[model samples]
Target: MTENKIIIKLDKDKKKELEKRFSQIGLSMNDYINLALNQFLIQGKVPFEIKSPSYDISTLKTKKAMLKTEEEDIGIIKNSISNSDN
Candidate 1:
């Protein structure tokens, strides 16, 4: 999988908090993205809604959406692979 750098616009405090959370799990942003992509291919669908965010140049503020990570996807992927053996 090809990896790319992403510049995220988030509050300093929230970004710091997320960095800490990611560090605790030993998952860098790229690793998390690859995991998500693997799940998407395994599931054969985009997990999140596909929408273009409306950007406001004048206000310099955009609507922010947070994606919650799923810990159960690993188990789900394992189940999918095991079931395929039947």
Candidate 2:
């Protein structure tokens, strides 16, 4: 079989976090991808769910979009809702 290469771009914070988690579990990002690919080939389907992010409505952007607050800046931790719910 012919080989191929795939490139992926990740956010800096997410890359750091994933690296930490993978290290704790004795795995690299490439190892994880290979395992996932093998699982897909064995099962003939994707093994994980693709879900939207949960949104923080307390953030300034959300409030601004809703036009429900006087605050003009993103605030600290407050609350969150499922992206699917909105």
Candidate 3:
């Protein structure tokens, strides 16, 4: 079943252009607007491509802490191996 609905207060030129585009895609005005709105609400972003840049942290203290953890693990493993040989 289909129901009739009315939309008020849209700019005439914009609505006409939208209708033309919608017709090209084989969709009615309501369908085209609803599809666009549903996608926008669900995604919360535009459907266009974007580029992001990367960053690096060059902190010596952080690197030293990581190395210290690795050294401690290696020492534990070596001790465990030596004790198992008894």
Candidate 4:
């Protein structure tokens, strides 16, 4: 993988806040930034899966996207019905 440099400007207070948060989560500033980048590229969301005390980290990491619920699928059905009704 090609490594690149990115320079970001943050206010002093914001930088301090970010450093504290990252330290609390056991991630260095670099690692936290990389995690954010990976989330943006891989899943397009942060905190991708639910965190559970019973589940291992690997299990949580491996969780797939949830299957669409029946209610979610009803949109297509409703659209078709509306078109036919017209």
Which candidate gets the maximum lDDT versus the true structure?
2
Q: What tens digits encode model 1's per-residue C-alpha lDDT throughout 1-86?
A: 68577776889998788778888999976677778788899999987877554545433342221111132354432322344555
Summarize candidate 2's per-residue lDDT along 1-86 as a digit string, tens digits. Answer: 99788898999999999989999999998889989999999999898976544554456567565553233234443335434755
From the highest lDDT down, the ranking of the candidates is 2, 3, 4, 1
User: What is the Å distance of residue 29 in model 2 from its true position?
Assistant: 0.5
Q: Write the per-residue lDDT of candidate 3 for residues 33-81, one digit (tens) a residue.
A: 6786778789997545554433224465677667777876878433323
Error of 1 at 21 (Å): 0.9
When summed lDDT is taken over every stretch of 10 residues in candidate 1, the lowest stretch is 62-71
Q: What's model 2's TM-score? A: 0.53
| Of 1 and 2, the candidate ranking higher by TM-score | 2
The C-alpha TM-scores of every prediction are: 0.40, 0.53, 0.38, 0.46
Tens digit per residue, CA lDDT, model 4, 1-86: 89999998999999999899989989888998888788878886764566775487666555522223333465522322243555
Model 4 scores a TM of 0.46
For lDDT, candidate 2 versus 4, the one ahead is 2
Which candidate ranks first by TM-score, i.e. highest?
A: 2
Q: Can you list the residue pairs that collide in candidate 4?
A: none
Instruction: Write down the lDDT that model 2 would get.
Output: 0.75
- Stronger candidate by lDDT (1 vs 4): 4
Worst 10 residues of 2 by lDDT: 69-78
